[model samples]
Target chain A: MAKDNLLGGSLWDAYSNKVTTLMNNPQHQGEITEEEAAAHGNKLIVADFGAESCGDAVRLYWEINPETDVIENAKFKSFGCGTAIASSDVMTELCMGKTVDEAVKITNIDVEKALRDDPDTPAVPPQKMHCSVMAYDVIKKAAGLYKGVDAESFEEDIIVCECARVSLSTLQEVIRLNDLKTIEEITDYTKAGGFCKSCIKPGGHEEREYYLVDILADTRRQMDEEKMAAAADASMTGDFENMTLVQQIKAIDAVIDESVRQFLVMDGGNMEVIDIKNSDDNIDVYIRYLGACNGCASSTTGTLYAIESTLKEKLSQKIRVLPI
Target chain B: MQVYMDNNATTMTDPKVVEAMLPFFSERYGNPNSLHKFGTSVHLPLSKAIDQVYKGINASDGDDIVFTSCATEANNWVLQSVWIDNVLNSDKNHILTTEVEHPSILSTCKFLEEQGMKVTYLPVNDQGIVEAHTVRSFITDKTALVSIMWANNETGMIFPIQEIGEICKEKGVLFHTDGVQAVGKIPVDMQSVHVDFMSMSAHKFHGPKGIGALYIRDSQPLTPLFHGGEQMGGRRSGTLNVPGIIGMGRALELATENIEATMALIRSKRDRLEDALLEMLDDVMVVGERDNRTPNTILISVRGVEGEGMLWDLNNALIGASTGSACASEDLEANTVMLAIGADNELAHTGIRLSLSRFTTDEEVDYVIEAFTAAVKRLRAISSSYAKVGPSPGGEAQACDLLYHHDNDIVVKH
Candidate 1:
């Protein structure tokens, strides 16, 4: 019979062929008995972990060669959705030949990528992404049990995403390397704040010590400061005093557009350079406030000070920003 | 062998119903409101279809049956119209309903509550059923309406609609029932029930989708859901869905014919399937008493196995089923009926509903029983909670040998 039933199409279609096949007939679905471990002169380790969010649990069994700390055989029993079963299956397979120390290095992304039938398509749907995270956690749990330590001790770095086990340093490094501007781009790169998004902001499933929003904002700010410093060094060689009035106005406008305009625009305000006059020893740049900035109380005090200081720092030391 | 047991969601459209609707789409296609002979010729069959609906529910000529898009629209129309007619115009400002009602009724009541209406959501017992006395105790003189479902879509537990309807009639409050899951599967007599309004969907009983009707007793005064062309006696206004009405009418006619015998066959198959599952699997339970539920439905919860896991295994074997898990739902919230019935949070995610139809065969039921037993065995072996042995000694492992206590039945196996 054809499997073209009305609703059954979408349920199985959400998974790839590899995941579906592994979920049905997982190769390593049994446990490693203590007798079998004794025969091989190995240590038998059983680690059980449960996800409270979806009531899914997994028990990982490992037969590690005691002499070399190498995992000779690994198996898992998963009591969750099909995606979790397939994930645990692949996770156990990936831990087979690696040493106990090397097995701890395996991440959820590696398990999910191994389950993918194609390179581009995801192994499971987005909602089921937490299954691979469960796989990653159970490995840590098994490693922890064998090593006689807490499972969290395996993570040496400051973990930012508990769901994906992504560390703060990894998120920062990925953000800096990719020049990621949005949280979606960060998720695409590191999968931080992807599942159970309590780490993304203040109000989510739980309060977190670190949030992706703050991290992204802080990283972007640092990137901006680095760019400004490099541009300031390059602009120092260009003499503002020898340039014509048009060149002076253009330089001031460039500085304002790069630095001051973003802050003002964020507050629903803007400014335009009207003219630049070289008076006495100071270069006065006349500006007009537009939109919500027109006739504002801060236009003369705080806003004027910020514009003037930014121009002095970025363009030249003698430039004065006057709001006309 | 493809077996479909998710009739509570929707059933395969009956070929006889499809045959009845085919001509109205092309050869007999005519707007009933047109002034020409092509339009006037349709009134005979239209009235026959209306008469068939009236007979399906044992309604009288004095009553009104307004066709709508589906049962959801009919439910919304009844609640919102009562909010306008009774709550806004009169001093009555309260509505009573059960917590286990379909989202259409629950969400509409929620919208009314936001609009300053006092609504009471009565709770169900562990069997997932609402008693009639519960409805009576919540009614006050300020009550405008009492809305309840004739049967639960999840557990198939039939509510006491007759008793609740009698209480509403005595209290002088309007009573409505979402009869979407009850109409063709069971005998619904509007005359004996004292129900003022009832909503039903045709697709639930093998009719084509996108068509349903609302039964209004004595053509009672209520505001219309739509305005414009004066169709449905000005109670609901729009161009009539000619083919949908024809299909629904024929489907209901066939469903009601020899209904007891057909349901008896389906009931035996449902009972056999249920018994086989309970006897074959450990820690598996039916959600409600078989005597209390519709004859063709079973909601079973297998401990240690998630609902989606069972669905995936069964779907692979060419069997279609449904689950009460929020993970399986689009809204991603736990099943409200399971929660309202006081199931433990974990057990609530394990509910899987299988509804049989008259078209379901005995061979299909046997296949499902075998498939379901195999799925339970295969899934439980991998389950962390269904551990048959304790942890190895001195292993420092968190033992997963769990003792599940349910209804004074200790499910502890060494």
Candidate 2:
């Protein structure tokens, strides 16, 4: 969220479109039945997790093929808030075809990202990051049940700053959530780079999974990629489909040639595009044929196919031509 | 009108203290270090202010009082001076403190440890009381200083400071106490206790803010942490805050006048609030109830309700209180003082400190009791943790437990 959220509603505006959709009606929220497990010839894994601070609990179910280590099916029963339900639903969806080891590597960031419409906006606000964390923890719990190991045994990642007690994931989340571009802002928020001065960069502190400087650079790159992805989506030809009829005709006129107009105007006839309409499989471009071309027979056979093929090749594959 | 009870965090500066400081701000503004009559005029009053501050702390009425910016500064100076003295003397280098001490002591000890000084942070009992014998046992030839607090800022548990001071005197070790909470409200007689160094703050007891003093015994070998031009015979070198020092002197003098009657009145109100809490609220844990505390402080923990949330409700009702310690409450971790007293995380999260001064009255007490009762009801009614077993009805006032658990799912209540 921005400082003032020039957009109204801070928490609501921070949520991505996909999170709002899933939070309203979660698609993959249910318990995996024993019969479904038997039919797939896979073992059932049930994992229950509770957040110690907030008393929110979630039970995740995964049916996996033991030999292939693939999650044949996934479902969840969430006894938490709407954010947790959305995050759990997305986590189960992400685990549907992933192996146990592969699922184990999916962090809370991955779960939050999966629920985001795009990578630019977060699925939930910074405070609700813990719900996604619960989602991530339950995946590890389910995987641990299948592998016959403790979920806590997987916490061997290098912790960066011990003085301020900032871990690697916390710094990454702060960096990603606020779009932090500098190391000093990281210190101002998380106090990681403030203390011991060791974790600011590799030279100051002991070696770790994430140096503060490195997280800033990686997050900045991710932010740039997000901007470019949004730009790429807006600039594609689908942009024409969302335009008004007048704007669409103007867009189609920009692609036509003056020589093509001259070809029609040569025999005391002229064609001018009036409106464009789109249907399921066709785009009907209406034209006002002037100067005797309205009554010419060749206008239908020759000029019709030429305009139709040109529009289909230039704008979209679904385009068609009609003159009225 | 708002009834302020969070004097442990700070106080409403006494009007008298403010009146005394008014002239020094502009009318009598002269650098105490000047040579002219403007500077020399404040010399006698500066001596008088130091004398009053000395009297307030039971020190010999003289210039042994080194004024600092605040209690945290005074604390840091005392500890750092000991460390620096040890560096020069080439003798004992160990310091002993407790786990429940304010961060001014604990964080300084940590910084000293990073510089290769050994610190022993002794734990406290379930009631947040530290026996004097624990400090006695920890003291050795290598121990140069023992820094304890006169009373805890969070729980208001008065430590056995006089007893520990005697033991330190017998062992030939210097004892320094951060007496920020205890100085003005409680009696202090240097003639009785053998405390070698003590720290005091002005604002904790209805004085002005941004001024504090540290008492150093006349003949103790000390090294100043700051080195500058002559100030306090070069013990602490900085330009004197003339107005703040004058206000502190008058505030301490006013706080100590007819002290027994004031203490009695404060004790009644504090005790009455504690009784009302036990009678009007359910699952209340009063920290340090078994131990001797100062008369004006009460620490209570309500089950299934947050300490900060309780404070917000109190603020809404025109009441003032603190949770755990206001200075360190910005961090979301459980209160260290509560945890040191064997409180579990959830219990520690619900700790609120209500401190009173002589300025508090009977009407404020009654209003606070009613406000607190309603706030606990309001918070508990909405708490999810309280949903299973809602608040038990208020029972008759009894000896409240040192700790209480509301449900069986979590048993580490105390």
lDDT winner: 1
- In model 2, the Cα lDDT at residue A31 comes to 64
Give the number of the best model, judged by DockQ: 1
Tens digit per residue, CA lDDT, model 2, A1-324: 687756445444566878767755678766666667889898877776652132244667788998999998887765444466678889989999999989988877788788888778767665455567668877877777777777766656545554454788788788888877788888888877553354566533123456778778877788778766654564464565545565667667876653357777778888888777778777778787888788899888887787777777767777776778
- In CAPRI terms, model 2 is classed as incorrect
lDDT (0-100) at residue A224 of candidate 1? 84
lDDT of 1 at B172: 91
Q: Highest TM-score: give the candidate number.
A: 1
| C-alpha lDDT score of every prediction, in listed order | 0.84, 0.74
Provide the TM-score of chain B versus the true chain B for each model in turn: 0.93, 0.90
Task: Give candidate 2's error at residue B59 in angstroms.
Answer: 1.7
Q: State the TM-score for model 2.
A: 0.60
What is the two-chain DockQ of model 2?
A: 0.02
Error of 2 at B346 (Å): 2.8
Compared with the true structure, the alpha-carbon lDDT of candidate 2 equals: 0.74
